[model samples]
Target: MNARVLVAYGTKNGSTAEIADVIADALKEAGLRSETRPAAAARDVTEYDAVVLGGALYAGRWHRDAVRFARRHEHSLAERPVWLFSSGPLDASAGERDIPPVPSAARAATLLDAREHVTFGGRLEEGARGFIARMIVKQGRGGDFRDMERIRAWARGIAKEISKAGPASPT
Candidate 1:
């Protein structure tokens, strides 16, 4: 038996979803049972022993669906080990100019007693850009900044924590 971990994410251009997939894969490799789904598909967190929620940041705000999911599962999440992540901000610099997760999302993370909230680099694809995004890209402010090694390291850390707890009875 292994702890079941849910890795749910909300994405605008599919970047966050791919990040979630890699996380789930890492969890599985570490001997935890993990599932990755869009936030909309994850209506409840009670069934999983732990949770990893992620979303794409938009104008310093987390994707709406991820925020909604956090609200909807507030109680269940509060009782479980939870981690939060957001992917956005094309700036390679990790310090200033990094777009943060919005206030409401931060509040939700606090309420859930999230183990950690990590903000990762993001990518803006030309093919997926909309009017405003295209304009921003045209201004030369677009590039892939996602650091896969950082993402994998974070997932490994989560897996290590889950493993330390040993197997959990699935709900």
Candidate 2:
């Protein structure tokens, strides 16, 4: 059976959600079964063989919903293969170097025994919520800073690892 993976994320302004979708797409292309969801709406982790959790970074903090999700399902997540991601570097630094997760995300990774955590470039186009986002846009600092090809490559690596592990054992 194709291993089912949950690709869940917490996003502001929709960029992180797009990244989650890219990850799910890559997994599917590698002959896995994957589903994408907003972390707030994903109430369980036990039904899936593996999970990819992500959050949008704000002021060096992981998004609140993603944090809560990991906590709520901590034990179940620890029982399965898990990966974490963060998206919210409006600059090219994420592409140029490996960015570390904020404290909360780092804690979650340790708590869940996650295999890896990645930070991806973020986008802040017009219509992003919040006053600071608006100010950044008004100041002409807003643009799609996300590098899609790099994101895809990262997801493919995840797929490769999962595939190498073979199909999930029956629950």
Which candidate's lDDT is highest? 2
Which pairs clash in model 2?
none
Task: Give the per-residue lDDT digits (tens) of candidate 1, residues 1-171.
Answer: 388999999898888998899899988988889999899889777889999999888777889889888988987887778999998878875334444457866886888889888888888868665687777678888888888878888999999987887644443
lDDT of 1 at 118: 83
Error of 2 at 156 (Å): 1.2
| Residue lDDT tens for model 2, 38-79 | 999998788888899999998889999899999999978877
Report the alpha-carbon TM-score of model 2 versus the true structure: 0.95
Colliding pairs, model 1: none
Instruction: For candidate 1, report its TM-score.
Output: 0.90
Q: lDDT of each model, Cα atoms only?
A: 0.84, 0.90
Model 2, position 8, has a per-residue lDDT of 92
- How do the predictions measure up, each by TM-score? 0.90, 0.95
